[model samples]
Target chain A: MTALMIINMRNILSVIMLGGIYSLISAILFVVLDAVDVAFTEAAVGAGISTVLFLSAFAITGKHHDLKRRNHFPALLAVLVMGAGLMYSTLDMPAWGDAEAPVHQHVAPRYLEDSYAEVGVPNIVTSVLASYRGFDTLGEVTVVFTALIAVLLLLGAIREDEDQS
Target chain B: MKKNPILRETSHVLIPVILLFALYVQFHGDYGPGGGFQAGVIFASGIILYVLLHGIKKTEKIISLQTTKLLAALGLLIYCAVGVAGMLLGGLFLEYNVLAADPVAGQHWGILFIELGVGITVASVILAVFYAFAKFEK
Candidate 1:
C-alpha cells in the first residue's frame, strides 16, 4: 500500500491531477488510432464537462465518500479470469504497430487511399462517418439523442415545491 | 441582473470566437481534424458559457427549454429526410451517387446535405444536454 499523505488537501489535488493525466493520455491514444472525432468527444466530455459536473455533484453531495468496501471477491475473481483470457488471446495477435498485420492489408487501406476519390471528401474519417458507414453514424447520433431524452426524463421536469424549497 | 463583470466580459469576448471556430470546423472538416460533433460541442459550450455567467433563468428566456426540445427532434428529422431523399433517388439506402443524374455532382450534393444534417443534430443535442444540466441544478 502506498503511504497516505497525512494532509487531506494533498490527496484531493493528487486525484484531480491524476484524472487530468489519464484524460490527456486517452486523448493522445485516440489521435493515434485515427479516431479524431472520438478524441474530440473524449477531450470535451471527459476533461471538460465531466470535471465540472463531478465538481458540481461533489458540491451537492458533500466531500466525504461512503468508504465501506463492498464485497470484492466476485469482482476480483471475474477480473482476473478476464485478464487471463485476454493475455492468452494476445499471444496470437500481431505485434503492435506492425505494418504487416492483417488489419493493414485489409479494406482499411482502401478506405485510407481511395476514400477521397470515392466519397469526394478530404477528411476520410468524416467521409466514413457521414457517407460509407452512415447507418452506424446514424446510430451514434441516436444514442446521443437518446441520452438527451434520458437526461430529460431523469431530471428535467422540475418540481415546483422543490424550487420553492 | 448584475453579474461578475470579469466573467461577463470574458464570455462576451470568447463566445464569438468560439462560434466562428465552430463554423470554421464545420467547413474545414473536408480537409482537417474537425467535423460536425466538434463544431457542435464548441458551439454549445459557448451557450453554456452564457448560461454559467448570466444564470440559467435569463438564458432560458433567450433560448427557452421548450424550443431546445423541438430543435433536437428537428435535427434527427433533417438527417432522416436526407436519407429518404437518397432512397427516392433510386439508390440503396444512404447511397449518395444516384441523387443526381451525374454521379459526381450527386456525391457533392449528398455529402453537403449529410454534413448539414450532422451539424444540425449535433448542435441541438449539445444544447439539449446543457439545458438538462442547467435545469437539473435549479
Candidate 2:
C-alpha cells in the first residue's frame, strides 16, 4: 500500500525502487510461509532483475514525470471492486495450513510418500518441479526463450531503422 | 558510472561474489532452496552490474551480443535434447528412468542436466535483454 502511494506520487525512480522493496517484503513473507524457493525467486526476479530492467528501459525515455492530473476515480473503483471480490472469495477458502484442506488431502500424501523412493532427491520441490513436471518446466523455458527472441526482434529492428535513418 | 571510481571498484569486488553465489544456488538447489530461475536472475544481475559500472562496450568485449544470443538458444536446445534423449532411450518424452541402469541415478542426472539447461538459458536471455535495453539510444 505504501508502495502504491509512492507510485502514485509520479516519481518514476522512486516507484521502481519501491516496487523492488515491495518484492523484497513479499519474499520475506514467503519465507515466513516456509516457501524458501519461492522467496528466492521473488527476491531475484522481482527485486533484482525487474528493477534493473525498469531502470534501463527508463533510460530510453526522459526521467521527469509528466504533470498531467487526471481522474483516478474509475481506476480506484475497479481496484476496490476487485479487492472486495477477492476478499469475499477467500472467506470460502480453507484456513491457512489446515490439514483438512482439499489440496492437502489430495496428491500431497502421495508426493510425500513416493517422492523419495521414486526421484531420490531429498528436496521434494526439486523432484516435483524438475522430474514430475518436467514438461511444464520445458514449456516455461520455451516461453522465456520466446520472450528473448521477441525482445531481440523488436529492438533489433528499431536499431536497424535508426541506423538507416 | 565510469567517473565514479569507488562505485567501479566496489562493483568489481562485488560482481565476482554475486556470480559465485549464483553458481552455488544453481548447483546446490537440489539440497537447498534455489534453482535455475533464481540462479539465472542472480547471475544476470551480476553482469548487469558490470554493465552499469563499466559501459556496455566493455561488457560486450567480455561477453558479446552474439554470444549471449547463441547461448540463449543453446540452453533451450540443451533442455530439449535431454527430453529427446529420453525418448531415444525407449522411454516417453522426459521419462528419466530409462536414462541409466539405476532409475534413481537417472533421475538425478536428468534433473541436473535440465536444471543446468534452464539456468544457462535464463541467464543468457536476461543478459541479452539487458544488453538490448542498455544499448538502445534515444
Candidate 3:
C-alpha cells in the first residue's frame, strides 16, 4: 500500500525501486503460503530482471515524469466502484485453504492422485505444466518470443537506420 | 559510471557462481521449486551483471546481439521440433507417450527437452531485449 503511494510520486527510479520491493515482499508472502515455485519466479522475474530492465529502459527515456495535477475524482470514483465490486464478489469466495473449496474438490485431486502414475514426475507442478498442459506452455513460450520480436523490431529498426545514415 | 576494480573483481567472482546456480535450478526443477522460467531470469540477470561491471561493449563482443537473436529463435525451434517429433511417432501434437517404448520415460524426456527449450529462449530473449534497450542511446 505504501509502495503504491510511493509509485504515485514523480521520481521514476524510486518508484521502480519500490515496485521491486513490493514484488520481493509478495514473493516472501508466496513462500509463507508454501508456493515455493511461485515465490522463485516472482523473485527472479519480478524483483531481479524487471528492476534491471526498467533501469535499462529508463536510460533511454527520462528519469522523471512531468507531474501535471488534474481532476482525479473520476479515476478515484472508478477505482472505488471497482474495489466495491471486487469486494462484493469476494464475499462469495470460499475461505482461504478451505479443503472443500471448488478448486480443491475439482481437478486438484485428479492431479494429485494420477500425476505421478501418468507423467512419472515427483513434482506435480512440472508434470502438470509440461505434460498435462503442454499446449498452454507452448503458447506462453510463443508469447515470450513475440514480445522479444516486437522489442527487436521496434529498437533494432532504429539501430539499422542510424547505421545506414 | 566510474570503473571500480572492486566492482569488477567481485562480479568476476560472482557471475560464474550465479550462472552455475541457474543451471542447477533449471535441471533440478523436476524435484524442486524452480524450472526454466525462474532459471532463465536468473541466467539473464547474471549476464546483465556482467554488462554492468565490464560495460555493454565488451559483453556484446562475448555474446553478440546476433547470437542472442539466433538463440531465441533456436530455442523455440527446439520446442516445436520436439512436438513435431511426437507427431511423427504417431502421437498427438506434443503427446509424449509415443516418443519412447515406455510412456513414462517418454514423458520425462519430453518435459526435459521442452524445459530446456523454454530456458534457452527466455534467457536469450531477455538478454536481447536488454541489449536493445542499452544500445539504443549509442
What's the residue-level lDDT of A46 in candidate 2?
93
TM-score per prediction, in order, is: 0.83, 0.94, 0.95
The prediction achieving the highest TM-score against the true structure is 3
What does candidate 1's lDDT look like per residue over B6-49, in tens digits? 77787889988988998888778777877777777777777777
Candidate 1: segments with Cα more than 4 A from true spot: A1-21, A32-35, A56-63, A70-74, A156-165, B1-3
Candidate 1 lDDT over A60-156, as tens digits, reads: 4455543456787998899899999999999999999899999889788989898877777787788877888889977887887888788677774
Which candidate order results from sorting by lDDT in descending order? 3, 2, 1
**Sort by TM-score, top down from the best:** 3, 2, 1
Poorest stretch of ten by lDDT in candidate 1 chain A: A1-10
Off by over 4 Å in 3: A157-165
> Which candidate would rank higher by lDDT, 2 or 3?
3
Q: How well does chain A score by TM in each candidate?
A: 0.73, 0.89, 0.91
Docking class of 3: medium
**Chain B TM-score of every predicted model:** 0.88, 0.96, 0.96
Off by over 4 Å in 2: A157-165
